[model samples]
Target: MRAYMQGGGFVVEVDPDEIEAFSSRWPCSNLTVTSGKEFLFSAENGDILDAATVSRGRRFSTEADDGSALAALADDACRFGAQALSLTDVLAIRFPDLAQAAPRP
Candidate 1:
């Protein structure tokens, strides 16, 4: 995953094909009554990546591709909410194309 920040906005970019693989590893919500669960992503570098799940309840226990948020991404969310967050080397991403620019691991 690639992360960055710009204009005080958090940004995270992952490969489109990586979504399914990532989601399977990190399940977001299991609520079925039109409820919503939030994801918080924070990294050792103080980078936060946050993405909210689709506003409706899920029919199954599976999470959506876009439902998962990186620990590194949550830092921004925490900060955006005016809450306390801790991490180092923070990076707020505004451009998603960095996903492509990111080095392959």
Candidate 2:
């Protein structure tokens, strides 16, 4: 998807088909349900941490808006495995980017 700055904030575009392919029986947020898609967040200036510097501020980032929070969710799914997670947990944590991109539900 194209990435760029708009009005001093970062923007990320997502493909709807990819979104559905990624999640199936796992429940989605009201936002995702209504929009029928998932979102990813980005920053206008840049990522909070350069991957090379991913260690220093790896904790839950305050900048982790809705879109970015999905990264955390993906992390959870990876770290714990799909069967281990519930729809609520995935829907609860707001990826910064997703939050912004998620159409108000």
Q: Where is model 1 more than 4 Å wrong at Cα?
A: 26-105
Error of 1 at 24 (Å): 2.4
Please identify model 2 stretches exceeding 4 Å from their true place: 25-105
Best by lDDT: 1
The digit string of per-residue lDDT tens for model 2 on 1-105 reads 333434433333333343344445335521132122222222321232211111233322323224543453334322222112222222334334333333333
Clashes of each: 20, 19
Residue-pair clash count for candidate 2? 19
lDDT of 1 by residue, 1-103 (tens): 3444434543443333344454455567222223332433444332344454334343222243233244423333433322122222232332233333433
